[model samples]
Target: MGQGLSCAASQDHRFFSAVHFGDLETVNAMLERDPSLLYQTTYDRQYPLHIAAANGQIEILSMLLERSVDPDMVNRQKQTPLMLAAMHGKISCVKKLVEAGANMLKFDSLNGRTCLHFAAYYGHSDCLQAILSAVQSSPVAVSWGYSRFVNIRDGRGATPLHLAARQRRPECVHILLDNGALVCSSTGGYGSPGTTPLHLAARGGSLDCIRELLAWGADRMQRDASGRIPYVVALKYRNGTCAALLNPSSAEPLVWPSPLKFISELNQEAKALLECALMEANREREKNILKGTGYSLPSPSHSDDGTDDNISEASDTELCCICFEQVCTIEVEDCGHQMCAHCTLALCCHNKPNPTTACLTPPVCPFCRSTIARLVVAKMKDCNDADQDIGDGGSPKLRKSRRSLNFSEGSSSFKGLSATFGKMGGRGSGRIAAENEWVDKP
Candidate 1:
C-alpha cells in the first residue's frame, strides 16, 4: 500500500502542475486511473485540496473533498488548507472546507493562528462570514459573548482582532467582535508590540473599527504597556472621531492633540507670517521710496543687479519654508528670513502642542541647519545646474545678474520650489512653486 501510494504521489505531481495550469480534464484522467490518488501529497506536503484552496479552484476542491481528502491537513509549516483558503479569500473553497469539518480552530504550528486569523488579516469578508456561520452551526456553543477572539493570542500572542485592526479591515473587525473577539487582547508573542486590538485599530486610524471595539466593551481605560490608551493613540493621530469615542464627557469639546498643537503652532506661524508680511511691506515700501524719491532707479540692468543682490541676500537670510506642503507660501520673517512655509510649519508647528503632528522636523538640515524654514514661492526657475547657486551669494557678477530678473506673476517659473532640495535633484526652487499651487487649488 505504501509503495502504491508513493507511485501515485509521482503521478500526482504531474497532475498538480496540470491543475495549476487549468488542465482540468487531464487532472481528472490521472485521478480516475487511481481513485486513491485524490489523497496524494506533494513534495511540499500540499494535497490537491491545498492547491485548490490556494488557487481558488472551487470545482477541483469539491471533487477532492468528495473523495474524503483531509481538508485540515497541515503542511510542514502547520498551515492547513483551510488557512490557505481563508488567507487567499477563496470563499467557495473555505465554505466547502468548513462544511467538510475542516478545523477552523487549528492554529499554524509556527504562528498559533487559526484559519480565522488569516481570513481576518486579509480582509476576506466572505470567507470570514462563512467560517463564522459554520462555527455558529456547530454543536460547540460558540462563545459569541466573551471577547474570546479578542483576547486569544496566537503564537505571537496577537488575537484575531489584532490582525484585523492592524490591517485596517473594519469589516473584519466587526466580524471578530460579533464572534466574541476581545478588543484588548495583546500578544505575548516574541517581539509583539504588546498592543491591544484597540491599540492597533487606533494606530491605523480606523475609526469605525475602533468604535466597534469600544461598543463591544473594549476597555477604553486599559493602557497598553506603552502607557498609551487607544483614545490617546487616536488623538495622537488626529483622528477626531476615534478620540471622541474615547472621551465623551468633556465640557469643552476635546480637540485632537495634534490639531490643538497644529493650532498653537499655527498661532506661532500666524505671528511669524504677520511678521513676514510686515517685512515684505517694508521692502515694498522701500521699493516705493526709491521710486518716489526719483533716486533714478537703476536701469533695469542695474535694478536687476540690485534685485539679484537682494535675492541673494534673501536666499541667505530668509529660509525657504513650507506651511503644510514643501513650499506653500514663502515665509518672510520679521527679519526678512525666508524658507518653505510648509516645511517650516511642519518643522516648527505640526508637532507642537499636539502628539499627532510631532517630530516632523529634523533638528538640523543635512546641509545647513539654522533651524530650516519651509518656503513657498510665486514662481519656479529653470536655471541649469551652474545657475542653482546663482542667488545664494555666489560671485558678485552672478548676484548682479540675478537681481535684474523680475519674477513674472502666474508664470510657471513661479510655481516650483519644494522645501527639500533633494526632491528636485538637489535644486530647491521648483518645489516651493508646486506647493503654492497645490495649496491655492481648491
Candidate 2:
C-alpha cells in the first residue's frame, strides 16, 4: 500500500508540473493513461486547472477544461482558477476562464474576495475590466445584478474600489468609478474600519487615486471609524503632498459633471476632451497647494524638454478667447458659441461633483449665457473673418450686448478670470501626479 501511494504521488507531481510549465503533450499523455489524475489534488486542494491558470498556461488549461475538469473548482483557500489568474495579472488566462464560465462571484477562503477583488487588489486593470465585462453578459448580472456585484463586499467589507485605492491602482480606481461603484462606501476591516476609498488612498499616499475619488464626489470631511478624515490620515502617514490635496481648507476639487445626461452621452473623442479638461482644472488647484514650498511643477507641456504634443499654432479665429493659448475646438449647439476645449471643460466640471443630477442644472454658454445644452467639434474660420472677431489679445473685437467672458477687455489672456479659475492658465492641459512626488516616506 505504501509503495502504491508513493507511485501515485510521483505521478501527480509530474502531471502538475507538466501543467504548470505548459507541457501540454506530457499532461495529455498522463491524463490519457490515467484519467483519474483529473480528480486528484495536492494537499492544498489545488488541481491541474489551478496550476495552469495561475501560471498562464492557456493551452494546458483549455485541455484540462475540455477533458471535464471543473472550471470553478477551489483550493483549500477557496480561490478558484479564475481568481488566481486575475491576481497574477494573467489577462489571457482571465479571459479564458471567463469564457469557460468560471464563477466570478466566488469568494476565496481567506478574504471573502471575488476575482474582481483580486484583480483590483493586485492592480491588474485589464483583468478587472475583463471580469466586469463578463458580468454584463453572464448570469451574474441577472441573479446578483451588475451594480451590486460591482460594490460587493469582502469579508472585511472592502469593495473592489477600496482595494484598488489602497493599492494605488489609479486606472482601476477610474474604471470602478466609471462602472458605478459607490465612491464613498466604507470598509468594515478592523485595520481601517469605516474607511472610505478616499481614506485608503490618502493612507497609501496615491494622488491619482485621491484625484479620481474626489472627482467622483468622495467627501473629504467624512470621518472613518476612528473619527479620522482622509486629510488627518494623510498627515499621520507623513504624506505631505497628498495632505495638501486632502486639506479641507483648500478649494474643492472639480467634480465629474455626472449631472448632465448629455455629458455622459458625448462621443468618445469629445468626452475624452472634456475629461482631460476636468483633470487639468484639478491639477491647477494642486499646483497652488505645492507652491511656496520645496516642490516645483513641471511646465505645461509636462515634458522636461518643454514641448506639448496637444498644442499647435492656430489662426487668430481659432484662438480660445478665454486662454488665448489654444484653439477653440469645442462648440455649443443652438447658441453657436465656441471656446477652447480647456475652457469648455473648466466651465462644465468646475462644480463639485454631485451624486445625483436631478436637482442640478447644465452650465450655460459664457457668450450668450443661454443654457449650454450641447457641445460639438467647432469649425475653423478664415483668418480675415477671425481678425474681425479679435485684435491684439484674445478679447473679442466685436462685443455681444451681454457680458463678454467677463474679461476686462485688455487682459490678453485667461488671467482675467481669477474669480472663476483662481488664476489657472495651464498651456490648456494634463495632470500633476505624473511626478509620483506624493509617495510616503519609508
Candidate 3:
C-alpha cells in the first residue's frame, strides 16, 4: 500500500510540474508513456487539467482534454477545470473546455458558485463573455433548455450580476445584462438581504456600474436587510458621484422637456392646482370645526417643550431653519444644529431640502457649514413628562427618524410621476437630457 501511494504521489508531482511550467513537450511525452497519469491528482486534489487551466497553459489543457480527461472533474473545492480557467481569465482555455463538453451549470460544492460567478467576481469580462456565449450556444443548453444559467444564484443568493456589480466590472455587468441577467435580482444572506446589483454598484462606488445598472432598469429604491437603498449606500460609502446620480431631484433635470410635452404638462399643473385647493379647503373646514368646539390647535412649542423652557428660549430656536415654521425636532449628527423632522428627512433621507430642487452634493450642515454625516431625530418630552436633563455631555436619546420609512413607497410615487410625465410627450426628450447631464457633470 505504501509503495503504491508513493508511486502515485511521484506521478502527480511530475504531471502538475509540467503543466505549471507550461512544458507542453514534456507533458506530451509523459502522457504517451503512462496515459493513466492524466487522472493523477496533486496533494490538494488538483488534477493536471486544473493546473494547466489555472496557469493559462492553453495548449496543455487542450491536450489533456483531447486525451479524454474529465473536464468536469472536481478538486477538493469541487471546482472544475472550466471554473479554474474562467476565474483566471484564460479565455482560450475556457473556450476549449466548453467546446469539450464542460458543464457551465456545474457549481463548486463549497459555495454553490458557477463558472460565471467566479469570472464576474474576479472581474474577468472576456472570460465571462466567453462562458456566456458557450452556454448560449451549447447543444445541451438548447435541448435541455438551460439558458437561465446566466442568472443562477450561488449559496449566498448572489447572481453573476451581483458579483460583477460588486467587483465594479462594468463590461461584465453589461455582458450579463445583455445575456438576460436579472437587473433587480438581490443577494440572500443574514448580512444583506434584498441587496440588488444596484446596491452593490453603489457600495463599490463605481459610476460606470451605476450608469449601466440604471440604464438596464435596476431598481435604485430596493432596500437591503439594513433598510438602506442604493443612494443611501453610496452616501454611507462616501460615493458622492453615485449618490448624486441616484438622487431623485437631480435625476429629473437630466431629461429635457419637449415643447409639446411642456404644453401638455400645463394640464397636469392645472389638475395639481385643483387638488391643492381642495386639500386646503378640507383643512380649513377642520380648523373651523375645532374653533367652533372651543378647542385650538396646539402650538409647535407645546408639543416639544420639556420641563426646561430655557432650551426653547435660545435664539433662533422657535422655528426650524429649513422650513421656518415647524418646531425643530431633528438634529444634524456631530453638528447638533436643529431642524424640523420633515426638513431633516428631506435633506438627509431624500438628499434635497425640497422635492423639486436637485439634491445637494456632499450634504453640509445648513448652519455650521460642516459636513452632515448623518441626521437623528431629537427626543422631546411633552409638558406633562418628568423633568430630564438635556445636556451635551451625554448621548442624546434619538427618536426613530425617516430612514425607517418604506423606500418602496417613495419610489412608487416616482413611478407615478414618470407615468404622468411620460404621457405629456416629454419622456424620450427628458431621458436624453438626463443622460447627457449625467455624462457632463464633473
lDDT of 2 at 313: 42
Q: Kindly report which residue stretches of model 3 are placed more than 4 angstroms away from their true locations once superposed.
A: 1-11, 143-147, 188-193, 252-442
lDDT of 1 by residue, 266-368 (tens): 4443545433332222222223324433343222311223322234432331223322112224433222334443343323321333248543432232222
Stretches of candidate 1 exceeding 4 Å from the true structure: 1-13, 34-40, 142-151, 188-194, 231-442
Per-residue lDDT over 300-409 for candidate 2, one digit per residue giving the tens place of the 0 to 100 score: 41222335435544453466666555667888978787787777776766534345843556776665557877788788787667555554454343332112445434
- TM accuracy, model 1: 0.49
lDDT accuracy of residue 16 in candidate 2: 86
**Counting only residues 3 or more apart in sequence or on different chains, how many pairs clash (N, Cα, C under 3 Å) in candidate 3?**
5
Best to worst by lDDT, what's the order?
2, 3, 1
Candidate 3 lDDT, 157-179, residue by residue in tens? 99999999999998899778766
Clashing pairs for model 2 are: 389-397
Model 1: lDDT of residue 440: 9
Model 2 global lDDT (CA atoms, 0 to 1): 0.77
RMSD of 1: 19.6
The lDDT per prediction is 0.56, 0.77, 0.63
